[model samples]
Target: MSIQRLIFFVLSALFFIGSSVWIKDEISPKWIKYQKEYYKEQAIKVEKEYSAASSAKEKELLGRRLASLKRPVYEVKQILLKGDYSWDKRLNGDKVDRCITCHIDEEKLKEKHPNAKEFPFDIYGCAVCHGGIGRALNEKIAHKGIYYHKRQMEQRLVAAESLFEFWSELANLTPEESDPNQRLGMGDFKKYSITGDKAIYVGSKKCLKCHTGLTSPHVERWLRIKFKTFELVKEAPDYIAGNEGYRKTCLKCHTTGYDETTGRYSEEGVTCEACHGAGEVFSYFMDIGKALEGQKIAKVGTFGTPYNICGPCHHTRNHEMRLKFFQERGADDEWFFPQHTTPYKTGLTEKGDASKSLPKIY
Candidate 1:
């Protein structure tokens, strides 16, 4: 075709597409309204059939069956995964959480183990004990840890700050070349950029709400920093806290904290967040808006932490920093501290079975 004719045809098609009712290839507003009306009719028809139900069980079953009915669109339909569920509860006077909506299994555990007082899904919500953005429904936002994010933000900030401290000629370089570390001050790193489902371990603040020194001594003991003037602290000159390898690899599991000694919070120590990951993501599958069920709970470690999670550190390896550091410092692994191949499973019943719901710290 001639350039002029081809150009004209292309322009004509573009104009038609832009002006069409199906903007962005989605259904038209008129068609959506029609679909809504059709669903409404279906709902009414289902209600009429439900009225003839004989018993409560029958009604319940029928209700559940009807709930699965797919909603139609202009030219398509979809099975709604138990319509926008939200489990909300009052933590204190003002604090509220909708975590139970997705973590319905957590709610069910109360029934599973009637004796366990701690699993009170109402009095104690998920986000309270486990640190996370409570109000966030999105997977990434909800499980973000304040401790990790803060450090990440600080690192980004510090790196950006350092880039400008030592400088070379920038008169003729391009934008990318001018800045080696890329952009400076892109707002808060945690809030704006770092998009991971990191469980913000809430230290012991939430646990302390109900538990006291009498009830939870181990928890309290772990959270504290007691540097006795009499006793000498273990010195690791090579494995300094802020060193490149230590910061990157060692402390990801050695302990949960902003630094080597102190935790994210002053009272923060190795809480549930240490072993069990951020509870919010594991409990609630955001895609389905439902709590993980049965074997899924065990696999995900939603309720209980498995020993396998600690394999990254505990598992034997060659040329590992721990081994090399120990060897160089004339420290014997067996002498200084006996290294276990696997972290012993804690909080188990006498029979070695899972404690159902109760957390009996072994």
Candidate 2:
């Protein structure tokens, strides 16, 4: 072939190859950048979701933030293991002195059990239950205790009362009766009757109504603090569960009444009457301008007040439910309630056991 003809053929072949490459290369660097941006956006979304979740249980699943951001465990070991040792370490956010200074309970320990061994009580050590990085000398690791590996909130330990309450709820559940594959028997409410006044069990909705437009600063602060994922879920509808605007967030505390449906609410916000006791009895006098006059309102504690109500749930301990009880019962159920509160009497009886519920300490 002539030189010009050969050159013409090579140019045509090169043009075809270039076209094929362009057709195959669908993904560009810009496309990769867009994907990275997409993931970053997703991460932000999960963080917001975690922040918006009201229930602790919900928070666990939704929590997408890095572990370091969560609340740090205020460890007692760092202080107790330190030279100036003590029993009760009343820790302040990651401070050795804060804990040791308050919990020098060796004097108390000695007074109570003269024969018992001294400080850094392995059984009674702050680290045993409340975790922190024990070996760390720095304030962050020392005071902000150890991470709870098995549990959701890796930082501090779950409150004892919270654990107990969870157990109590579990005890009340009847998966065996509800599910065909279930092996265990259902829990019974036969031992001690649920004796609280039916009037006291107001649902969360009643609280939300007044709370929504309440004038007080306290009410305003609470409204602001309450978690909601309306905005994020609005864009990603698939991620959300309920209606775009209205949904139940208040049910976390203001539990549903016995007659009421599980999620349904008769009122809005946490009503004053619910916390202060059934206004049916108390409010009668209050309406007549003599609330404190005729008869004292019926309540759970001695004075019929909130301190009693909040203590059982708020001032809860770590081992809310004593697992040993379940062990003693020989019940190998996976859904074991921690031995929180007097379980048996409150319809949370262990398998076959008939122990009465403990007295309310409030």
Best by lDDT: 1
Please state the error at residue 118 of candidate 1 in Å.
32
Candidate 2 least-lDDT 10 residues: 188-197
Clashes of 2: 29
The models' CA-based lDDT, in order, is: 0.40, 0.37
**Pairing residues by index, what is the TM-score of model 1?**
0.29
List where candidate 1 sits over 4 angstroms from the true fold. Answer: 1-199, 213-234, 257-269, 276-308, 329-331, 334-362
Candidate 2 residues lying further than 4 Å off, grouped into runs, are: 1-197, 200-263, 294-308, 311-362
Clashing pairs in 1: 145-200
Model 1 lDDT tens row, 1-362: 99999999999999998878346334343335544665566667777778998899988976875675444333332111111223553223334455443343343545543423522445334442344665554445666763333344334322222212211111111123355534322111111111222334444444345446545775555445321200111233333423664544534444443334333332223454444333333232322343333123213322333334554444545226554554444443332232334322322214332222322111
Give per-residue CA lDDT, model 2, range 7-83, as digits (tens).
Answer: 99999999999987666543332233333454455567668887788998888766634343343232332232323
